[model samples]
Target: MFKGLAVLLVFQLTGEIIAFGSHLPIPGPVLGMILLIVCLRFRTSGRLVEDIERTSSGLLSNLGLFFVPAGVGIMAMVQTVQSEGIKIGFILIASTFLTLIVSVWIFIQTRKVVERHRETQ
Candidate 1:
């Protein structure tokens, strides 16, 4: 776990450096995640990567526990949230509905592609 954490931090730091150096629109953490994903998708497997996979799996399996602090933070923001809450609520609702519609459209398109492949086969 410690080793895995160190690697994760390295990725994040690297991403931060890339962000500052390149002045990218995206966040460091996002780039770090992309880096990690690409590393995982590498064709060659090694002992170190295997260990990383184990640790990452363990961490991901307990992701909900990590969100507890965030949940608590939102719970603690009761007073501040009372003001300007309507605008936030509207944005959240609109974005969620937009995402849902986009996801459904993507699903339908993927299904059509799959259906076409099936017919050709």
Candidate 2:
């Protein structure tokens, strides 16, 4: 578990370095996740994968704990949130819808590709 966590942190740090050096707009963690996915896809280490999966499952089981900071942040910025509540709500709703639409579209496209691959096979 520690090893898997360390590996995750290393990837994130590597991504942060690359993003900072390249001045990319993307978040470091996002880049790190993409890099991790690519590495896992090409790598042939079942034990490493198993460790990562176990670690990921453990982390996910406690995922709700991650929201504590966000909740506290909102509470800290209560005045600002009240002042811009309408605008913030609008942006949040719009972004949520946009995300849902994009996710659905990606799912559809992936399904099509999978179906095509299956047909060819």
Compare the candidates by TM-score and give the number of the best one. Answer: 2
User: Residue 8 lDDT in model 1?
Assistant: 83
Kindly give the stretch of ten consecutive residues in candidate 2 with the minimal lDDT sum.
Answer: 44-53
lDDT of 1 by residue, 1-121 (tens): 6787788888888888898899999999889888988887883587767667778899899999999998899789977678868987999999999999999999999999999999999
Q: Candidate 2's residue-wise lDDT over 12-104, tens digit each?
A: 998999899999999888899999999999985788888888889999999999999999999999999999999999999999999999999
**Which portions of model 2 show Cα errors greater than 4 Å?**
none
Model 1 stretches with alpha carbons more than 4 Å out = 100-121
Would you list the clashing residue pairs of candidate 1?
none
TM-score of 1: 0.71
TM-score of each: 0.71, 0.93
Candidate 2 positional error at 45, Å: 4.6
